[model samples]
Target: MGLLVVAALAGACGYTASARYQPSGATPSSGAAHDPTTDPASATAVALSVAAGAATETYRTDIGNATAAFVADIGTLQEAVDGGDIGAAKSDELAAQAQYDTFRQLEGGNAVNASTLDELATEVAPNGSFAGLHAVERDLWTSGNARADVAGLSVQAPVAQYLLSRDRLTPEAIGTTAVSELGWVVSTALPGREERFSHLDAVDIAAAVGAADQAFAAIEPVGRTVDPDLTTSVAQVFSSLEADVGSLGPPTQVPDAAIPTTLRLSVSQQVDATAAELAQLAARLAPLGTAGAPSS
Candidate 1:
């Protein structure tokens, strides 16, 4: 059962959100074209580009691993539940709780990069629509703690519940169902809100943020559910929690009510999407592996 929880965490951490960028006709000019052999600026530019590229790749890989770990943990928890190993499930829950705490600490410790934010704003300024919203969302996740903490919290709790309720379903069945539901939440429900919030005005953003806060507050009870509700209430709570957190002021920003409303909306939407996916994954544990296979 402990092993199963570990697997679910791995799966959650392994879950990957698709990159929002596309190839453009305009490629970055090679340093050779600008004589990197002699021109210091060109040489420096080339070096910086290489470094940036490497960093980006590393970050992407880390994010992917984290996502996979999270999903695996979920799978493990479901298995524990199916096998009726409540003690093991509780142990897994403790492990997940520790990980989530660490994630929050890491997230809170890091500061948002000004240059990254500027770059995101620049990229989105041209699109000024859903594309822009997505750009901001990507940028937000690129910041280490922001993505990790959200994903950690989103995957941990429900899995714990599933494990505690192992008497209700088969391990394989629970695992399969959880993964499938997560896929649906990510592909459909989350993206839908992103599109909707992309069009919000400043006042609208504030209202949405407040509403999300209230909704999140209402969900405190659900967290205690040994057999939780994984319907729209869960989704609503997740959406609200995401929005409330995402609407927080940037690391270095002037205090203006309207400033970054669009960006806030984007962040909120992404968070909401993540939360919804978590709930969906939890709910689907009922139909995982009814046959002879182990929980994937």
Candidate 2:
């Protein structure tokens, strides 16, 4: 890709501005010396945005680390396989797969360039371009060929640089994305499709769930300030969902059916409940930055 195309790829990820705030004029304006205590809604809106911004920074940092680690792991896997250390190569492959899952959501929105990186990192393409993580995985686990030029594959620098250039996801976007991510985890990721060859579905689930929780945490303080009861409920349900995931134990190398049906049902239910509560929270917070309420 050219320099311009690479630069554009920075915005080539999945995400939309879901949290839409009303015009500044909609909220009651305070004078320069106005106190936050006098304008609770406006104050809360600012707090929410600030909290989201801080969390976005942290998330970005984590993504940077994950991307770097993934690249390094892929490199190590290549070396291990080249050096004929099959056991060490398999371990490295699993670690690399988990690291990629850590930031997979970022690829949710980059349709234009998504396939470019996906092809490089995964075995999705039928063409001969499938030469990175998944190809190596197949070789190690299934194909037994164990020969893909992983040394030449490059996904880290572009992904990391793109993150640096991308703007922070707004509070509204984060809320919507979190709900969607949870839903995806329960609906699709749990079935073992994400890490099919490695059978590391648990790793993908844990990473995704952790990210959604982080997103919710960013706006949660504002939610507490506005609706403590609902916030508490959200927190509790999230805790339950996390515990359910934890019950699955370590990442496994088994078929999807090995996971109990009952646990899957339980996870699905918790995900539904969490999504409902989170959506309600998003709706409630949506208007807080808008027209002021009548004085009680």
Candidate 3:
């Protein structure tokens, strides 16, 4: 729904969370002796233990805190529109968009919240595919009659978008979802007009990557335990990806000449490479491996 807190911006300037590291019990890559007759049940238990710990403790807290912030921003946007002050509405819309950049990304790929919000946006906005932030953005950015006080009156759609995931959000599920969202960013959102109405592709791209990082953080310890080389590679690649996106400046302005588009082609290539690494990591962890691949 919003940032993990009002304290700092994870997306706006390519802010990053501190990486949490845990020691790996068995170092398999060093030709270390394997456990004698590894039991299937024991392996399963370990995986489940890892997932449960990550999901419940880290992932849940991040998403839950952000949800509260997003809900509050939504209220601000609604109030501005209700007042019929286009100036105030524009300011609130931009503020709301900044938060929505991260909120939408937190959902990962085609989440129920993302889909529902589109319908809700259409219900209260002009013709288009994106009805949420973009819809309200149109009224703020456009000229003449097109720029009017328009936004969904109800916050139900957005509220649901950020909160429903609490009860049963497995780290494996979230990891896969994060990979899917990242794939889209490289293949479509970054190159294309993701936030066409707001011209905020840079913002969205940064937010999407940040969201992936959050999901990846939950599983990083497990990844390192399984394959330290692979985990290290993922971390390096992620650092590069964030730096590339972060350099694009803010959503309100055009990107640098080097990255005339929201992201440079080289940046897109880096994402693909990162996806391959994540796919390998996920395969070792769970069936979520397929999510890192481009959709057929």
lDDT of 1 by residue, 1-296 (tens): 54454334424433221233221222112312443322324434333223222322333333234334534554554455456565554344333322222122112122222121112243444544222122323323343122332233344434432322222222222222333333333343333332222222222223233333332233223222212343345555556554454454431222333445565455545544645544443333211112121123
TM-scores, all models, native as reference: 0.24, 0.71, 0.68
Query: lDDT at 225 for candidate 3?
Result: 62
**Which portions of model 3 show Cα errors greater than 4 Å?**
1-52, 83-88, 98-113, 119-130, 144-153, 161-163, 255-258, 261-263, 287-296
C-alpha local distance difference test of each model: 0.33, 0.61, 0.55
Rank all candidate structures by their lDDT, best first, as comma-separated numbers.
Answer: 2, 3, 1
Query: What tens digits encode model 2's per-residue C-alpha lDDT throughout 1-296?
Result: 33343223322422223344442332212233643322534544345444444545555566667777877877787788889998899888777766666556666655433443333344455554655555666677785766544554454425533643364554444566677778768775787666557666776677678777876886686666656787788899999989998887775443466678898788778888998888766555543332111112
Angstrom error of the Cα, residue 260, model 1: value is: 41
Q: List the residue pairs that clash in candidate 3.
A: 1-70
Mark the 10 consecutive residues where model 1 has the least summed lDDT: 286-295
Which ten-residue region of model 2 has the weakest summed lDDT? 287-296
Q: Measure candidate 1: CA RMSD.
A: 23.0
lDDT for each residue of candidate 3 in 1-296, tens digit (9 for 90 to 100): 22232222212222122233221232233453653112323444345344435543566566665565666766776776766676776666655554554445445455545653433343443544444556666656674222222345244545554354433334444566667767877765676455555565666567677877777787787566656787788899988988887777665565323356434776788778777777666655542111121112
* Per-prediction CA RMSD (Å): 23.0, 9.9, 10.6
Whose lDDT is higher: candidate 1's or candidate 2's? 2
